[model samples]
Target chain A: MTAVEERAGAAGADDYEARLQAFTGVELVPQRRGSDPVNVPMIRHWVEAMGETDPVHTDDDAARATGRSGPVAPASMAQAWVMRGYAASVAPAAGHSPFDDLAELLAEGGYTSVVATDSEFTFARELVPGDEVSVSEVLESISPEKRTGLGVGRFVTTVKTYRDAAGEVVATQRWRLLRFRPPGRGPEPRALRPRPAINRDNAFWFDAAREHRLVIQRCAACGTLRHPPGPVCAACGSLEQDTVEAAGRGAVHSFVVNHHPKHPAFDYPLVVAVVELTEGTRLITNLVGIAPEEVAIGLPVVLDWLDADPELSLPVFRPVAGKGT
Target chain B: MTAALRPAPASVAVGDELPELAIPLTRTLIVATAIASRDYQDVHHDPELAVQRGSKDVFMNILTTNGLVERFVRGWAGSAAVVEAIRIRLGAPNYPGDTMVLRGSVGAVDGRRVEVAVRGENSLGVHVTGTVTVRLPGGAA
Candidate 1:
């Protein structure tokens, strides 16, 4: 089929009002396949970057010796792989959706969409590397908005599910999007928010304001640089450390774009990304001037600063221009 | 969902059920999650307009709901199993303070793919309910 037909298939029709009314609780669209798969190494980077010093992802022998099929990735870190095709666009031939696909679908359907508020799962089995999992998701339901706040429309409800490679259901994620009209606007000038930051914090090497440049507070006793600001070093358990900026370039590692914004002041098509710094340290920041589709792991990037506050310069990254999209 | 606590376990029997978890109903919690999820829609944070339509309080967001589901399930499933996929529906108004019970039933097992039925219930009735498809190690089948 043509690419336009493909994106429409992934995102659904522009005339959502009628399609929504005919919604039958579930619509299992064919997945627009991509090459990106969650490898064990990627999972390790994600877990370590999130400050989860768990050995399962880091120590291979320990994981294999544990009687597990293989190194078990953190369950919470599942979000890394489970959300790949969320906003994937059909081939360029698909054409611009009547609305921004999902946004227009919601607006046209009159469904007040919002972030997924709650979810529940039953882990029947564990997954490891070399396992090719087939993810099949379906549009469960769409709850239309029937209220407003600050003179804007508001409503929340959008649920979906994912299946594993074995055709077994691995995760079921229900997303609630609190869609609202602009606080004050004429017709429709609102925008979607970027997805929230992953559980990543409590680091000493960097801050949103200072752009630490990879400074590690030296552990007066043990000589080592800590990217993730910790009270004590893992090796010698030393409390003292030093701040240092290693090389500012690293691979893209992994990243996500937020077409559906979460904050009012935030810009749409928001890019929340994670980068593996030159010192092998990983950091999370906003990706500017690059389209989400253009983003790829292993893609090199450089640190860019933002002067939100004269005293506090926020550190963000931009795709090394000319290197790629 | 009764706001009672039970021994939290990773593995439950075919009929075993999960104790309901209740997060207090507050406009702030809704807004904090809204901000975190990058979902800036105001209806969740504004109650007056929420009341204007049909909800009791500003409704909770899908992002927060998804986050809560991720948190609740991980807490129950022992942070080990890989979450492959989940599909659910938001039934009644999940008001703050209302404890929510995530009910599950091991329906059928095929190798590692365990067919199960699960739902989220509160004092108001079934708030969010659906079936779950999971992959387990050994299957009774």
Candidate 2:
């Protein structure tokens, strides 16, 4: 038998899969310090790279307009806060970790190369400037050896929990990696589209969608209702606001059929629409369950939930037939 | 925390030009900034991957462009100036081995609110064009 085959056979006989699975639920890395405090300079760099123009992340007045006291770091940046620089990765500190041990074991078994498969993030709150974040990683699961285009390998999944200086949980990430032998390469996978920029102003809106609830923010002072929840009421200029569950009914106010500059995360021709709710607020959302050509302005619609990725759930709109209301 | 450096609303006028600033782009700056922003897109940092994806090389991200625009406006508006709004649209990509020259002119002047028309150009052409509104000192909050 070939050397690789022999190693595979040996691994099987020794029940290496079970051995590796034992690491699940064990702490892999504890309390790794973030390279820097959440600051504006880094945030600026990020927004530039991502092409994000949200004023809440930069303009103080725009942030205050959304009811935030000041600037906020994008929730999608949770992992970036704790990234060890290239120098640290090249010359890591002399500390042994269960992560390193598992990698070594996988390498010994001819699964030396690795690539990130996907990541799932759950955020509890928006991170504001000056918050120092630390992270702890734990093994979540280890899959049995499976034959992939890259060769035989196992998927290693870990959960990273991020905490602020106050020890409040800010975000958690489920990171999965494929450890494989460096032969039999296949077609490259498409990268995920950048996640939505979530913060204190709109986090609750997203959270409510996960539970299949369509909610709109209402000014606690003047009873003005708004979608795309902001910090201040446009009419009353009140900072205090509350939420009201919607009847999930609306109509298409405007729309466009996207056919070019295609992003891998979505299918084209993608139907993007602006829907005006019965409550008089509007939202820019995707139109699903209907053909792009069938969509039109003033078409009555209803709310639907799109579990786009494992970690994200958003509200989409569907056309209503023979609408009277 | 200290005295404001912002020019008084009465002292500012329409068509006034803010001092220009030049930023040098390097691979480290590009990659480090992308990581800092929590952007892990290979096109922003991986030249080989970028080439495979049909880009000449790893290019600057829009977030960095927005941040730079904010920085330029804030630099001229002074420490006490509050940026009220910024609307920007991207054009050609800013790659390494080029310098982005940021220039701006006061578009309009209200009591305390000033609108600055700004553009950042690199060797390829215009990188970003936008307008920023800032509330200067002695202006209505």
Candidate 3:
């Protein structure tokens, strides 16, 4: 697998994809026996936790009625039987699994975090008490890169064949897992700021900001300027509206330095401030290019445009150099 | 226990609702079920390890969630129903002291097969949403 690591490091994305595709249909693990056979105690615990009160799972009479020899394990328990328990999972035995190799191969491409996206089980028969189950997994498919809300990830699907002691296939599972790059981890493309909800009322503001212009909605009837564009002017109760391009100067009327609950799009100790613009309208925007401690009420600032992604542009403020008073 | 199994596919209809099942998310449940399912991930059983791993506390493992989902469907569909498949997407984490109430509706019925759309909600928000496909024996699909 070290060879795989070296190749993955040197290869391009297409080469890596080809290398990963090579593992398709390859068995990921040897036929591994379950640590424990299907038994009543484990079934009891499982049913208890799951709130499964089906009598056939716990009553011999019910099992007889259901035409089983005795109480049978729930069909869903197929995966549980063959799990590599606490010991094996935390500290795997030497002669590691090929699945580990696949994981390492994926992590080389910055896909480290894993989450089960979907699973489908097709059952052949239910396991009665004392039936030993063994499982072997094969790489089924690897999807092309997908952009999810979580991050960029590739879905790896595997098929696990579960068999009883007689080597008869009892069930099989098609399992799909997303190996994603956790947010803010490992060369991830920096996230864009959460998109502001743009509608007829506020689209003009964002559109003006995109052109590096600071515009405020003005009431044509009463000469009142509003920071947030609205359908009707509050001051004069007028529906007539116009915009005025400001000189892009302001003072920090109020501000707060945020240290927790971070978003990947912005740096922190983020300075969010209410800037009182020279046009006499106060709008909330982020303050930039100044240390958090340097931010004070009445601090003179100048407008700047944050081209957040190719689509979004926001008006930000920064303390004016040489006029920090 | 006395829930009657739907003997015919015709007996089940689209838009049928399954009774809601609310499982109390106890700390014992989170730890015990994780161990029972053989998932030793610290985020499922060890609070300190979970905290270090960036989770606020021990959370339910996907396996246990799968089990519970199957149980939810079976408890309604009866023991004789064969669970052909389950496709679930997890959302909010089920932290301890939150109750996940599962509500499901029959989304589709095709002869012997029925698909139920299931949603489980906890205090944080939607914990899990998915669909369960169950096939009944002796149906003329």
Candidate 4:
């Protein structure tokens, strides 16, 4: 048989699409128990890795003061609790999971490349130490072949629900991914800028940027304002914090024109500047709407955004017309 | 000393080189850590799929890289030290059969806070390079 005939007989793209569609509403992971019970040590590790300072995740007294019984896990850590560590995940398992089957089918269809597109989560209750969590995932939807900048792919969405030992639902998450055929010769994969490491502390900042709002983190106790939100107040050491919308106004504090080590994702002679916000904080960002030579310290600038990728939106600074130093 | 114990902030000085930490990268480590971080991209766990995507093998996910960087800095800073911020940029991929060596030095010192300039290097080259700001105990008022 010819290659095309073999491929068609084995499993063509159309057959793969049909098979994938059949998986919608199918349970992928069924009642998978967490490798470890919710505890302070893992919470501590997560908070530290994410630069979170909220005391409730670590300090028992701080949690109690907030009217909780004790320290509670960060709501965003819902998935980490159920992670199958190196040993379990790599070891040969008993049965084939629906996710495995779906993945194999996609690979067979030449949609071997995959990337996570987005995830939405909702928390019903805070998890605490001793809470033995369990999770189950269901394939929600699978899109038809769509051409994207990356390649031709289908969007796969799944819903995972987390429950406590008593089977009480605590959190639910909608996860989406794109399974695509890697481009054979398409413009050397638009070099994707490295993804930002997001955790509980800084997630809200990115979320606000998605809506085109520039918000700054403020300590609820002493009212000191800070950028790049932290779990605790730097000045007052307060755990409680809030956010305030900025005017999106700032000025260039320092800058450097990068001329070498060109990354395909960015233009050459890139103007990278540190903008000093009117609120007295500094943010390192790209300076746009101006020439590299025009970039100068104290140059009055305003906030603009660079939709870096489908999933990333970064706040960039541009010189305010007729308001330069 | 174990990472659980706090190091005296007064004893740590600017320009002090932290003891290097070597972590062997295995296929399991690469894939498992990605799952732990809730990253399901096939390139991080499925080698066959990764090769099809142009990568020789599944690579380490960014979250796992960030987590390992945090672990390395905290291991040096001790349990009492609080990581205020960590900014990292990725370089070479950490494929299986490689050893990632984490090295750092105290970049700056300001009262309770010390900035650590860190880099994780593998056989291919730097896997990650970043700076971590940490607050050590006894120096805080």
Candidate 5:
């Protein structure tokens, strides 16, 4: 079998994982000391960048008045003190480091890239200015190969123990990284539109939309039409209900253009509008077949069907060309 | 400034509302806080990497979210307040170009200990919802 195919098989995976477990309990970093003692300058930069105004982090008088001896670094900044600076981070690592060894071993198995999945910190005690700190790390665990969104990979977990000059434990971090093979850029299939929540109350509306028809729920007793199907009618407290086929006409009552935190199913700069139907009820739906800039309040619109898929359909609106309020 | 200090133990009762704080989710804020927190995850700083990893843009990291929540609570509880614990879970991501408005209400109060139910909402939806437990500076009754 080819090397790549054999490494992907069950026996090859088992053989590879055995070597990874050998590094368990091995110290990756014996004692990497902080370049500088915990000081106000670093703390100041942290709080300012975070927009944190906690007096205990930077104001000595405020901290002293509050019972602390002086300013205390924010507890969340525990990892920052021992972080390798930009210069060291970009420089090539010395050949003797075990970190390089572990990385090389992983690369041999085709796990050449990494992404952080989770980090949990439990602080034993808060650090103060002028306190010297150092850190040591050991492999906590490495999972067998598993499939993930990034690709097939294994999880490598480690425990970093932070200590003060007195060797007392100040904090501990359980960090997990997913070392995976990069999935080359390929055209992903277009996402299907989001499905609507259909139940007995609203099944008829969607069923009608599936056939390219627009229907509204109407109270049988008082004839109050509602866009959303409900159990009881609000106008006359009637349980009796029926459906009314809409005239397929409306006007935009209000609208908004969505730009961020987007879903893969929908396009960006999406135009969503609340359309007031001719029957005196409103439905919140998306506007299709038009530019977002062309949508405005009181713009006349006509009903359109978005056949999202064979099993699902949605009612979207399109602005009527040259139609005025 | 004095008025912003610790609320009197008796003065803080259940159902009190803390003023809302709106934070603009700028790209600079997202990248700087991630680095400041020593989080080198590319998804929090590199927009291209973020998209490749299934995000529209670089988003705020959890550590930064925790820090923002702590800052919001401390601003209300005053200088003497101690953040005993912060328990939060992320929902929708806080992408750059959005504004996250944090709002909280007092849930439980046992003398100096107060529990605040906090939620941060962005343009998409609820981004973070969690409870922060703090100890106001005062003798326990």
Candidate 6:
């Protein structure tokens, strides 16, 4: 048999897995030291990108005004940091990450690894500057699937927890993948590992329970206000920054009308739009109240935040109150 | 986390074929995709998770997978391919350095609306197989 198909085949599964088992275990050995405290620029970038109009994530003084030590980035932003540790730990060896290698070895065990069928994250404390987090990763269990990708031998169910230096569980996430074994000798399917990592507003975006506002981080040096926060000022490359409120007035630079309803995150036939604020920066968002046939480039638009999720407000734009179709 | 995805074709049709496009699955491409979408689950990034999970390497998530499909149709058909509905079945995992063929063929031609069946595949297998509906820019033929 060829080398590619050698493993994952009945005869090959036993033979190849023997060599891989002792080698690719991704279970964390010792706790890892994480990167420095939450970078505001990075958090700012994420908040702005999401078009969240919550006060806490965007306003530092506002945050401090509300009893916070300082401006915190976000709670669920752990996603921005978790994989970096996995990537660093896996860098020297096969160049593949612990997560990536797991799928490969499991496939050798006679299964096909599927990407997250579902995911969700629970947050405890907010991540802020000066807060150092260390991650503890654990492989929870192994399972087998019956009817996917020739039937996969699902091997890994993992929990990656991010704790402050104090051991406080800032965020905890459990992950699952559908691993299918070979059709004839498929592993019996058990309770599917339910993924609990759905997307949600980060802590930074939910700083205050009583306010809503759009945040634009301004580079202290050049007065350059940018959204979807970042480290370097796009124009001057200076990292000095602070959050500022915007007038929410702009012209549509471009837009698209989506008809596909894939992720249950939202309904189908939605409007995705890009607008250029007076500052000359462009931001992406969903345009509400406008139908597919009425969108056009250079159209005037205004900001309207979603009111339901107090912690999170979606920035949706619409034709200027009295503007074009 | 991903900026409400980039602008899409303002309009599309029932069976308009967006010319096939190629997206190199580079390391940067893969990682950027995961980060952009805020997908923290391990299998998408941890190689060991990949090994333990039973596959060759980290696989792309449906979010990124769908984003790619969105990007492909938008880039090819421009403001003409308005994706009304995107139904995709995850086929296989795509690793870094792999070449993804973003191919879309016409599905149906109904009045001013159209749909294009699409996929993003590598030699290992097709990673994303789906269909998209868009309203052509200048209305339908």
Question: Which residue segments of model 2 deviate by more than 4 Å?
Answer: A1-13, A184-325, B1-34, B37-141
lDDT of 4 by residue, A193-275 (tens): 67889999999999988677888999999999997678999898999988998888999999999999987677789998889
Q: Rank the candidates by lDDT, best first.
A: 3, 5, 4, 2, 6, 1
> Top DockQ: which candidate number?
3
The predictions' CA RMSDs to the true structure, in order, are 28.6, 23.8, 12.3, 24.3, 17.7, 32.7
Question: Quality of candidate 4's docking, in CAPRI categories?
Answer: incorrect
Q: Candidate 1: which stretches are off by over 4 Å?
A: A1-325, B1-13, B18-38, B45-55, B63-79, B137-141
What interface RMSD does every candidate have?
9.7, 10.1, 3.2, 8.3, 3.6, 10.9
lDDT of 6 at A230: 71
Model 2 lDDT tens row, A1-325:
3324434554464576577877989999988879789888877777665444566666677666545688777555667788775555457656888878887887766676554554555567678889999999999888877777545678888889999998998877777777776554442222344588889999999888768788999999999998789999999899999999998899999999999998877779999999999999999999987888889899999987766544466788888763321
Question: Would you list the C-alpha lDDT of every candidate in the order shown?
Answer: 0.52, 0.74, 0.82, 0.76, 0.79, 0.59
Task: For candidate 6, write residues B1-141 as lDDT tens digits.
Answer: 222222334445545566777767776566656665555556667778766656566766655665566556555544323344445666667787798888897777676456678877897887777665555444433
User: Top TM-score: which candidate number?
Assistant: 3
lDDT of 5 by residue, A158-233 (tens): 8888999999998887777787766663433345567778898989888888787899999999999987789899
Q: Model 2 chain B, poorest ten-residue lDDT window? A: B1-10
Q: Per-candidate TM vs. native?
A: 0.37, 0.42, 0.62, 0.43, 0.58, 0.36
Q: Global CA lDDT of candidate 4, please?
A: 0.76
What global local distance difference test value does model 2 have?
0.74
Q: Which of the two candidates, 4 or 5, achieves a greater lDDT against the reference?
A: 5
> Model 4 chain B, poorest ten-residue lDDT window?
B1-10
For candidate 3, the clash count comes to 0
How would you encode candidate 3's per-residue C-alpha lDDT over B31-52 as one tens digit per residue? 8888888878777877986665
Summed backbone clashes in each candidate are: 80, 14, 0, 2, 0, 73
Misplaced by over 4 Å in model 3 are A1-15, A144-152, A189-325, B1-11, B51-54, B110-113, B135-141
- Which model scores highest in lDDT? 3
Q: lDDT tens string, model 6, A155-273?
A: 45667677887878777666545666534555432222223233232233333211556566678899987766676788898977776666788888988877765553454687788
Q: What is the TM-score (0 to 1) of candidate 6?
A: 0.36
Stretches of model 4 off by over 4 angstroms after superposition: A1-11, A185-325, B1-141
